[model samples]
Target: MVGKRQSRREAVSEHKRELILDAARQIFAEEGLDGASLRAIAVRAGYTPAALYFHFESKEAMYAEVLHASLESLGSAVDQAVSRTKTPQQKLKAAALSFFQFYAANPRDLDLGFYLFRGGMKPAGLGHDRDVRLNAALEAALRPIAEAAIALGAPQERANLLMVDCFAHAAGLLLLLHTGRIRMFGASAPDLMEAYVDERIAQLVQE
Candidate 1:
């Protein structure tokens, strides 16, 4: 009876944690990071501020959880996209398309996942373990593209360089696109992304 009671308690705890995350995601989407407060999230989750504290020590802790979840989602999309393609060039193009589409569709998630503007800023209470996991998840998302480049005759070092270049190029454009900067030039984000992926694939084929 004690074991069954403990299992039920654990399940309940997990469910509540998920509820908090869902509420946080919505709030963050509506109001970037700074605008979303713990009180707002707690209310949205149908819990008191104290109850939210029991699950997450601070807003930073909760944000870290949300960021990690977003990274995992992007990583999964990349893996699935690559899996659908057989050739190296096709895999690279698919991975790029999957990445662009995911971020384009979920602008908030993209903002949460990419911390380039933050300049090494991490959420408070995000320990070394969380940092390692975040980096691992991000690398996993880009691994297929790098591997594909290697298979297409680029040396390992060259392939790694290519991966970094591709990511920086795409992410820079995406950030501009997200902030409506690209609109100044009368370009569509999806169209720009598709063309960028095509150019990358062509480069891979040539080298």
Candidate 2:
């Protein structure tokens, strides 16, 4: 009976942790990192501030947790997108397009995963672990495109560089779209992304 009770308590603890994380993600997405408050997050999670402190000692800790989880989910989405294509070239294009589409459609995810609360706030212990995991998740998301480039006759070093370049290109376009600069130039975000993927695929194939 004691063992069962302990298991139940652990389960509840984990559930509460997830709830906190979910609430934080939503709040961070809506408000950005600088604007989100711990009190707001606790309220959204339906937990008191004291209860939240029991799980995450600080706002930075909670942000790190949410960022790590977001990156993991993003990595999975990219991998699944790459898996749908059979050819190396198709894989490369699909991977890039998937990444572009995912970020474009989910601006909040782009902000949290790539932009918010990541610099200057050094987390100790578990925060360090989360950083390590975030880097691994980022690499996983990019590896498929790099691997596909290698299979298409490019050297591994150059292929990896090419992947970075591709990401930079897509990311730049997305940034412009997000900031409404793309609209100023009378360009459509989706059209630009499609064109970028086609051009990039051709460049990779020709190299």
Candidate 3:
């Protein structure tokens, strides 16, 4: 009977926790991290601020949790894209496109993942370990894409460097496109990214 009561309590606790997180995610997307107050999230979750304290100690921890899920989704997209392709070239293209497209389709996720809404370079307050974990999540998401590049015959060193270069350019282009500056040049974001992938692959093959 005690075990049964404990299990029921745990289930209720988890449900409330998820409800709080869902509220946080929505507010973070709408208001950005800096603008999202713990009070607001708690209110949105229909819980008192004190009640929220039982689940999350701080907003930074909550932000990290939300961003972790976003990165996981990114990693999954790359994996599925790679799985669909046969050749290394195809895998690389697929992985790269999937990575870029994931952000392109969900601009809000980009804002959440990248802290685009924060003014100045204020720290996210996630602490050292959480920061490292978030970085690991991002690197894991890009790993498969890098592996695809390596399979195309580039050295591991070069493949890692190329992955960084390609994604850096993609990120900049994506930000510009999302902010409407890219259209000032009258070039499409997808077309530019596709062209970039082609150029990088061709260069990799040549080198």
Q: Pick the candidate with the highest lDDT.
A: 3
* Count of clashing residue pairs in every prediction: 0, 0, 0
All candidates' lDDT scores?
Answer: 0.82, 0.82, 0.87
Put down candidate 1 lDDT per residue, 7-72, tens digits, no spaces: 999999999999999999888777766678988999999999889987888776787889888988
lDDT computed for candidate 1:
0.82
TM-score (C-alpha) between model 1 and the true structure: 0.87
Cα RMSD for predicted model 2: 3.1
Number of the predicted model whose TM-score against the real structure is largest: 3
Q: What lDDT would candidate 3 get against the real structure? A: 0.87
Q: How do the residues 88-140 of candidate 2 rate in per-residue lDDT, one tens digit apiece?
A: 98998888888888889888878876642344445333356766777777778
Off by over 4 Å in 2: 116-129
The sequence of per-residue lDDT tens digits that candidate 3 reaches over residues 34-136 is: 8899999999999998898899989988998898899999999989988988988888888888989999998978887776336766644467888899889
Pairs in clash, predicted candidate 3: none
Summing lDDT over every window of 10 consecutive residues in candidate 3, give the lowest-scoring window. Answer: 116-125
